[model samples]
Target: RAASYEEQGVDEIVILDVSATLEGRRTQAETVRAVRARLSIPLTVGGGVREPDDAARLLDAGADKVAINTAAVDDPTRLDRLAERFGRQCVVVAIDAARRLDGEGWEVVTHAGKNRTGRDAILWARQAVERGAGEVLLTSFDQDGTREGYDLALLRAAASAVAVPVIASGGAATVAHLHEALGAGADAVLAASIFHDGDMTVGTVKRALARLGARVRA
Candidate 1:
């Protein structure tokens, strides 16, 4: 899917295991090696990256960058170490967020949304950047498959909190949603089910984003 998206004029790709950490699965270096051999664009492999070794191994296996979620939330020093070793541009912090039922604002989730950290997403994003994360991938678990729309408020807050770029993920059902995400301060937008299931194409999204005056490579 990432390959196909790249063929469709997508700028970059991010592949997350999503269940690797929860299932105690190790990072798939083979998969990254294979994909790196096949694809020409920048690729980010994430999920189950708990330490700098894991991150370095993935990059050695052909990943241009590695994303950390559960591990970073639990131990932010790992991010600093990765940045110090591989450089900040190679580290991205992914935040799995959801609206707390208690109206405590957006809370960060872990282990594929099975555990809520009870920390504000924006606060955590700020900390991640301060601790040396180059970018943030903010995903809304609540709106993931619903395709309703992006959690704009959450994106806005994260954008304001971090100086680095923020990639908005989850609930992008239409081209309009892409526009809204950018308007809310997202530097990039990621969609899975919508593109994986053939509901929309990356070319369509890129065209729409371009029409809306967003910067996208040709």
Candidate 2:
């Protein structure tokens, strides 16, 4: 699958063991190694990355970057340590945010969105960047798997709050959705179901975006 995405022109690939943290296990370094052996594109691996050693293992396994979520939330200083050890360019802060019930704003969620931290998403993004996260992977918990669309408001807020690049994720179902995300201030867009279920291809989506006047890699 990783090779297929590469052939289809995906700029980069992100492999997240979503259950690793929730199930109390580390991301499978062997799995990352296997995937890395097959592709030339950049890869980002995440899940159960509690410390610098975990990130080191992934990097040694060929991941271009390591993403941290639960661990960073548990200790913001973890971000500092990771950046210090691996360089900020190799660190990505993965934030799973859900809209507050009152609809006022978004809150950061950890443990695969099962635990709410009540931390304001925008503020957290800023702090993560300040603490040395090179990039932000922002996923909308409410919009994830809904195929409704990205939470543009959340994207806008996070992108505006941080100087580092923000990757918008979740609830993407169409090319227009990707374009909207970019317009909403996302540096990039991440989609799963649309590509996994064969509804779209990276090449096709890039073509559509190009037609819409959005610059895309050939």
**What is the lDDT of every predicted structure here?**
0.88, 0.95
Candidate 1 C-alpha lDDT tens digits along 1-218: 56777788877888899889988876899999988887899999998999888998899999999999998888889988989999989999999999998877899999778898898888999988888899999999998878899999889988988889999999988888888999999998887787888987888878878888888878
Clash pairs detected, candidate 1: none
Which residue runs of candidate 1 sit more than 4 Å off their true CA positions? none
TM-score of every candidate: 0.96, 0.99
Please give, for residues 3-26, the per-residue lDDT of candidate 2 as tens digits: 999999999999999999989999
Poorest lDDT segment (10 consecutive residues) of candidate 2: 109-118
Residue runs of model 2 more than 4 Å from their true location after superposition: none
Q: Indicate the residue-level lDDT of 105 in model 2.
A: 98
Say what the RMSD of model 2 is: 0.6
What range of 10 consecutive residues in model 1 has the weakest lDDT sum?
Answer: 1-10
Using TM-score as the measure, which candidate wins? 2
lDDT of 1: 0.88
